[model samples]
Target chain A: MNNWFKILLLSGLSFFTLGKAQEKVTIGEKQNVFSKVLNENREIWIHLPKTYNDKEINPAKYPVIYLLDGEINFEYYTGLSDFIARTPYADIPECIVVGIKNTERTRDLTPTKSQKKSPVNPEVTLFADSGGGENFVKFLQEELKPFINKNYRTQDYSILVGHSFGGLFAINTFLMHPDYFNAYVANDPSLWWDNEVSITRTKEYLEKNKKFPAHKMLYVSQADNEEKQKNWNSDMTQAIEKFKGIVEKNGSLNYKHTFFPGEVHGTVSYPGNYEALKFIFKGFRTDIKQLAKNPGLLEEDYKQFSKKMGTEFFPSESYLNIVLKFMKSNDFKEPETYFMNLKNKLYPKVK
Target chain B: MNNWFKILLLSGLSFFTLGKAQEKVTIGEKQNVFSKVLNENREIWIHLPKTYNDKEINPAKYPVIYLLDGEINFEYYTGLSDFIARTPYADIPECIVVGIKNTERTRDLTPTKSQKKSPVNPEVTLFADSGGGENFVKFLQEELKPFINKNYRTQDYSILVGHSFGGLFAINTFLMHPDYFNAYVANDPSLWWDNEVSITRTKEYLEKNKKFPAHKMLYVSQADNEEKQKNWNSDMTQAIEKFKGIVEKNGSLNYKHTFFPGEVHGTVSYPGNYEALKFIFKGFRTDIKQLAKNPGLLEEDYKQFSKKMGTEFFPSESYLNIVLKFMKSNDFKEPETYFMNLKNKLYPKVK
Candidate 1:
């Protein structure tokens, strides 16, 4: 073989080897966005739903979930959203999950500059760089959201999710800027931070506003980490209960508080996030079998759900395709035709 | 530039572009295994734990879990395993997840050749190529298991996990070859197959063997999918209840059965799998704070757990390192020294 030809052939073979070496199962991609508010390069993990790039379906917009503590929760959280949002029995609409990886976690998520001596070693100080949450939210709202909106097809609806300090940030954001997100989920939030400053903020907000904004939802999950908490003289549980009481008493906010008995602070987020999504998208699941005979019920159900959510949610083209296939496979001609017409009406063919 | 040089430079640039185009968050990789027993090529998705290749610690062996319905469950299932298995408050040992993708779903997961008329369309037959489960298990035992064992750093302990027809296979496999795996998990098993053949088999096995084998564990999860079941005249719930009663009455097998409310047939696997893992590894969690003051208790707990499990389980090098770091950071000198000794005793320096 000629020298140049041999070198080129070798390079080509190496490329193919690298490509086929391992067929990976990937959940998302990592992208960097420079936040001027935080004045740092922030890395975000973005997971698009399975059908986001499907050529068969028309381009679609999706609700974006901003998940805090990205590196920890990105993998399972993304998987979960996709799993439950499967068509024909989708509990929630397909979503885009944007996981924000932390740089200085304590600095970013805390609402107040407070420090505590380590319980195990009183000589050591903790949370030395606390209180940058307000600025963090500003970065999210001003910089990150715009970047996401510009790059991806997204619905106006979005959610904020967090755990522990992240959860505290989420609650603070909800209280400070209620209209920023449609819903908020806080799992085992560190409400006891800075001697329950978040509780004070919540009370002040309620007193001033009289009521939480309609159509905004908040779901809080408290973990039964009693055994773990016993090690430190912490009022985490009490703070959470107090917040729960306040929220329940107010009765103006769409709120749900769950106490997971067996879950610890670290593990609560797994089930907590799952429950939060179900609670937020409560009316999304429609029985496909029921739809066979009562095809008109689909539209009626969606209308009622939209009215309740204060946001319009039509059936996705992908979901319609799945429904159509189900009806056709079952030989339910009437419903099959019904769905075909619905699909055509909602997503007309382009000339 | 010269033509050859330009071509080479272009190829190099293209390779770099391909590499940098997307930084993906991957959970696992896919591999093919030719199964002589089933006479076909089968694909498997393999997920290794985070510390599997960490150069900081010695290579460790992990318990292997063979997951069924790979296409649907692999992603979240892998994440769940890794998430819960984090050190210091780890609920279960880090595991190697091998998800077997389907080839012929009905044929491979069903125990007996059975057919049913589609409830929606009586003209159509369901489960046409049923009853290849025995062969499928044979493939696992002879080909797939060996391939995995050969390729990975695997512990002796292994688990079989499945749902629906796959769940039926797990149960059937447990009855036929209890010695093959250390634990078995069945999530909403189709015990009603062929007029409750699994129930009959369960009875016969109890009659012949007198009791389930010792040291082996079985976890069963039943979904309260009554609304879905109402569409088809199914004995699924009854069969599951009957099996649960028989197993509990036996009083010999290490078993647990849980019925998850509000979960449908399609969505049951997520929570079911989560509960199954927790149930299987109930005594794995230990308090890191408790270990700080009384480090000797760690070995005592492990000893007790090992005896109960009928298998020895040492703290991994990674876990001991975490403990040591925790103690050192907290200035717990005695416990830090104790764990250092333990680490040295368990995973000695090669040099």
Candidate 2:
């Protein structure tokens, strides 16, 4: 064999090993299943939270986040999950992330496709296959969700996150079928789809529905790049703003509209998703020392947050481990013993 | 024995193989060498730009970027390089990225050992044996740089990018050895080393040096997270602002200080590096269609930019390919022939 080829093979082996050698590993399981609705096989990447272990006797049931455009976006979101949910801070609650890779992105992410091309999109054939967004949502609802619930330890609450055309599908799904998810986050949604077909539906939905689903939230973000550029005409921002206005006019709708000024289409996902998740878990605090000092307050806070979020939201074993990690870092001594004993006393082992 | 463990092993294999399948990939060759200065085997990751092997006729010599804390951060920086240098827009010029992984982070990154502890750092014992930074710089100069130059196709121009303690090292190296790198980017540099030893040194250096090396730049960034929290005491930002003020007062120093308002110390590297590289390549344009229309102007621009950068710089072949890619996207016929013909006529292949 050629030297470069051998070196390449050896490096490839090292890359996989290096990925696993890290402590807070983000190794995801990829599974393929045939979808009856879609009439094709779909590959899904599912990342379980660090706390998840089937052997730990009724370990934990986590809320699921169904991330659209997950083929390319999973790695970044996985990093976010490792930091927010699994890291020492435990800044956000733990949840399983289900990243759904796509076969045809345009077919699945647009509500009603049109032949009309926006001046922003020069490629006329880009939106050729239209009107499959509703079916895609059905594929999620009727097929994917049931399979996940059947196989994994999942809670009742779930979140739907999307970007660009995926964002359009997320918002459209929320409007068309409001009870599908607990929260819907759309980042730089392609509202220009089908001549703003989804935006028109949003106004009509607001006029008729009078109130959105209980304990549900919707967030829409617009990249400021389009608005700043002279030729782009700011259509995406305008459509999103118009949607936000309609939601606000409804009075009972829980909605937020964000604008990332310096971010363009490609760069919006990083900050956009970070801010959206922050908005979702705005009240969760991570200072272990402060929380430890006021145990009663911490208890009350979790219970109240659980009630608000419609999930049993106590700190997971992994979360308590991080707290103990801080304690050990501060020279409190033998954090392993303290946390283990406390875990036994507070939440006894099933076996 | 467990099912999850078995699944994990399979996934690991899949991940590595998948990483291999991609063409013109950013597959870094990791090699180790015994450094006499450090008295240990040091690992370095060298990523050749996509265009390096595209055309075999003595392909381009790229500027090297030495990234500190490369073990974990290399993946992110690699993605950034792919986007900025290899992507369609080619927002930044293509260059080789050399990621330097650490053996003893504290020993090498800090300029001096300090007994004094900040109230924010709970672990007082974290900074022991912390005065090896100068030696590390020596190792880079004597061993690493010589090795890279001898082995790889690299320009004399180089950049040093570091975050946190590594940032401290970057600034120290720039102050002590101005000719080592053409640009220094310090993202949220921890300037509280040895009771502000480096900061004091920075003040004294600026007073004497009169002017920074021509065309060389230094950028410092402060994140908002440290400022918002009560316990953290906002020292990083304060120190950075003071340093920025000192450089500004020097007048002739090429300096820029940026603050990511909503970003924390950990989260700052992504946007910080992105913005810093943008600042470095602010004048390099990649719009190929407009450039193709006036080919003479594009050639002249590269020459002028090369002169300004104090290095021989030219748009890489991959950069040209992306231009033709845009042309192909916009209904321009036979992009390959035009680009090939243009490449032959304009930049004649080296014998």
CA displacement after TM-score superposition, residue A185 of candidate 2 (Å) = 2.6
> CA lDDT, every prediction?
0.88, 0.72
- DockQ for the candidates, in order: 0.31, 0.16
Task: Give per-candidate clash totals.
Answer: 0, 0
Per DockQ, the best of the predicted structures is 1
Local lDDT at A216 for model 2: 81
Estimate, for each residue in B1-351, the C-alpha lDDT of model 1 and write its tens digit.
343443355344531121134578999998755555776656789999999999988889999999999999998899899999988779999999999999899999999999998878899999989999888888889778887888889999999999999999999999999999999999999999999999999999999999999999999988886765675634788899999999999999999998888887788888988988998888888888889878998899899888878788888899999999999898899999999999999988888
TM-score of each: 0.94, 0.81
